[model samples]
Target: MQDMSASLEQSKPADSPRDGHLKRTLENRHIQLISIGGAIGTGLFMGSGKVIALSGTSILLVYAILGFFVFFVMRAMGELLLSDLRFKSFADIVAHYLGPRAGFVLSWSYWLSWSVAVVGDVVVVAGFFQYWYADVPAWIPAFLTLFVLLGLNMLAVRIFGEVEFWFGIIKIVAIVLLIITAAVMIATAYVSPNGVVASLANVVAPGAVLPHGISGFFAGFQIAVFSFAGTELIGTTAAEAKNPHRSLPKAINTIPLRILLFYILALVCIISVVSWAEVPANRSPFVELFLLAGFPAAAGMLNFVVLTSAASSANSGVYSGCRMLFGLAERRNAPAIFARLSALSVPVYSLLFSGVCMLTGLTLLFIIPEVMTVFTLISTISAILVIFTWSMILAAYLAYRKRNPAAHQASTFKLPGGVPMAVTSLVFLGFVLVLLALEPDTRMALCVMPLWFVFLLLAYRRRTA
Candidate 1:
């Protein structure tokens, strides 16, 4: 009512050196779509079937719980970024609140997480290619997708924003259609191929919520965390966003409802249209629903949608990954050459370095055909690293509360639940780590995580030397 956004844009601190440095070309719509694109991923499109099979109706509860914590994480992130627009990436804020050592660790770990995530996306992209041209080499689409996304990213930040804007729209349209089609089926009493009625009653059926007991429900965390991995991408865009003070809060605020609508509602439709018992964990339930309803065209459409989903994620990986590398170099944690910017104000060298990683991802697919399967292991590892990143964010927030009490009192954006949410979120992240260790396949990631810290420490010491 009092024109909060206008006030935010004008409410710069006395020492606002962060302003006017990076090109703030991203508008509110760009930031909003970026947030949406981050929240939805190949995990939801492909991995939901696995989670549904594992947790059944309780999967709804799983998403709700994780989504709540994610909101708090973003809230903490938004508060930190708004407090100082100079902070470019999460690493910047980590250094400010934590220390240079923590910054070095978080920065590289985040870059590693996205780099591996791009490999996983490339593998998925190649698999999507087989959906049509099985004869073509997997490396073709994998490298080709990376090339196109890299070209677009290197042009300008706005070009990347435009690509993601359309990508997010594609995802939104597909999910909205699913919810509508499923609702119509339920109203018409259309039955699924499995003889299940198109009704909400199926949610409570197939063993009543905890289909495989609480263990199975907890097992949902493995894939669920992967699904939610990129939700923090918005935080990386603070330095590029035209109105970080206004757009940042709006993007972070809408996460909870988007999770409910996109995840909880979409899954409810999937189970109601077909029994969760029948959904396969290995593939997307979206395609299965269409094929069950006798619509190969729709299945194919959903496949294309997911194909774009993988590309969208890869696009984000390059964007966020390059930004992290740039941040690290600027802080002298890495070689200073990566800190140089091109005429477009883009970090060209860092972007190309990440492109090399994407290229290797494609090469791995050809060299070791089994590498595609191992992509799941890589995805698990990415999830663990991202969890560590998010935990640091929450920990940074807690530190901010303690160290800057006056700033917190006078801040325009305030994270609710304060110390409680920070403590609970940290504990929940630890529980997810333990859950990862309990599972045989995912345990490797938790094991490899310590080695990553060791590498970062060694790299940090070498850089300082």
Candidate 2:
């Protein structure tokens, strides 16, 4: 809808803070696809199974509700970033508006959150690869993917964007094909060998929309919210984006449509092809659809799509984590080494640090394979941190509006509901925290969250002292 190049030219500030020597090599195409890559990942592809198993057909409404509300979160982030081109990273906006203390805690929380997710993704990359070659050492592929992403990121920001762009294309194409194919089959009253008909009737007749009832609907939030965790990634790219004003709003606007097509429509198709009750917990519903339709080749191709999906997530984490560190050092909240960039304008040390953290995931294959679930627990904890980070942005927006009423009034890129939207989004986030507490499995992360804050408080004091 927006003319990207024209908007980019219109929005570029004459001068802003130097990005620690970082380059704005990311083009419009790169940002668009990177935005897509951020929104689609293993959360939807792999974790959707758990959401389907727990939520039943109600996963549709769950994703839609989550998606619709979070757009305000993105909009607030977009307006704040557009208001100040000198700031880099979403965390910087918090620091600028809310004081350095809030910035210090959230910046670290976000970095740790994405770093934890990358560890999980690297483990997953290995697991996905093992499906093709069970004989190979699992850690080998995980380490390979970790190092490869590290290499790509080290070269330049655009290279990382380019790689992620293609990875996003693979995932997009796969979801589109699945949606179209399933629609045709459902229209024809086509039946699989298992005798499951692809029909909208499959959605309701089983047990109404909420098959498992209210508790089941609540159960889906734990995993489904995690599925939405990566959607805020555009915030991290704000500093490096060629044109923050045009690009940020354009990308933010697509969030609703992405939720509809990728999560809602695809899940709709999956349930229609295979009853929610029939969906297996151990395997991806996407693969199950093709295999049931007697298309092993299609199923196999989907496997690779999931593999690349995991890799793309890790790649994004690497990019964002380095930026977080860069933001921290720029604020003098992190060590000076992290703020330094290389000749290619890349945050070399910060990226290597994150890549090293991700490579540690390999130790799971050797030292403690049995307790590998630890990574998953850490990831849930990371999800909690991510939720806090988003909440911080919303909270900062409320502050920004009150503190700078004239700026808020003058901005053309407005948040639709203004302060009310931000307030409601915070309340909804609080409700999600309540949902996390209700589930025993996720309760641990909720309990552990406070400890992270305690550590952050001490760290902040030490840094400031």
Candidate 3:
């Protein structure tokens, strides 16, 4: 590992081109909010309804189980990143411990994952816009959003951080308000128009937990996996994060708690207010909860919240895609143009390339007029790619320990259970893959994912040649 790391270090020129390095302008608060934004994905807002409809009360267990494994994934990522500040991203760590080929594939895979996910997010945002302006063209909002985010991202890294910070704040406030309102309704025994009484009993009713049986319980993993797609995004921010040793660990350590509060507790509140059986699979449960509470304008208000949530997710996606492209360029895995930073230290060409890729969202919207269908398809592909990305992180971690025993021993933020936990996480991810095969929608994506790897293999070989 040491020799490989040294060779990798030696490969890059000691002197970089002017403004080649990314700026470390992202502060502790920015990292905190970005972490929150990554944790509370747009899937929780848009996809949770379907998860509840499928898994019933068992959705809680679904989030809990996925959250447990995801937390460990983040921890493993945190340790690997902090072990060396020279590691700008997990791809860098993978290249050092796994090999340049693994790094190349992982970087491009992660870039594709975010790129695909952003397409879904932009599609959803357009749908949210249509909720208010029923006659407006869907492509309008989608295009405007991409253009604005691209402009913000082009200015500087801090602007991107600020945008995500406020976006994260909006999502947090929305979830908290929903939880509180639900608690008040449950305490008052408010009865909905459907004659269902708001009570904690609704969440714990007999047969409620597995209303659709174990198949439904297992079925929840597909979108639930997509919901956790960006949980490891903070790993990509290592290059631009200020005080990474302090901020990265702090941000990652809170992931489990964030999942508990934002996902598990929030779902419990929603389920208690509206029976899991009544949760609309096609609509957001957040908006449903407010509408049940007699808020006539709940749809529009929650629509705005979810719109921003989706925008936040897309924004993060663009930023991550740009960084991954930039990283790939630095390693000579991609065109050198993407490695050139702007005067403000942002990767200008990389940002432009990502924005262009996201334009495919508009084309998808036109082809697939149904928003949910497009979202489900895109999200499944994103989830498959995410699973591959996380698996590589664990695989890289295991190799890091085997090759750098001394570094592992000296690390302050070591992944608990070490090799065993890493193995267990890998097994859990594999099980999720099997679950993906059970549903026709996700199964198609699972089957198609190999083509991406085949393409990557060809690209890697060509790069090596």
Q: Which candidate is the best by TM-score?
A: 3
Better of 1 and 3 by lDDT: 3
On residues 341-410, what C-alpha lDDT tens digit does candidate 3 reach at each position?
8898988999999888888656887887888898999999999999999999999999999988888899
Q: What lDDT does each candidate get? A: 0.83, 0.80, 0.89
**Candidate 1 vs candidate 3, TM-score winner:** 3
So what's the TM-score on candidate 1? 0.93
TM-score of each: 0.93, 0.92, 0.97
Q: Estimate, for each residue in 24-113, the C-alpha lDDT of model 1 and write its tens digit.
A: 999999999999998898778877887888888899998999898889988988888887676777778787778778988999889988
Off by over 4 Å in 3: 1-5, 10-19
- Using alpha carbons, what is the TM-score of model 3? 0.97
Quick one: RMSD of model 1? 5.0
Provide C-alpha RMSD values for all models, in order.
Answer: 5.0, 5.2, 1.5
Which candidate tops lDDT? Answer: 3
lDDT (C-alpha) at residue 69 in model 3: 96
Model 2 residue pairs with clashes: none
Residue 9 CA error for candidate 3 (Å)? 2.5
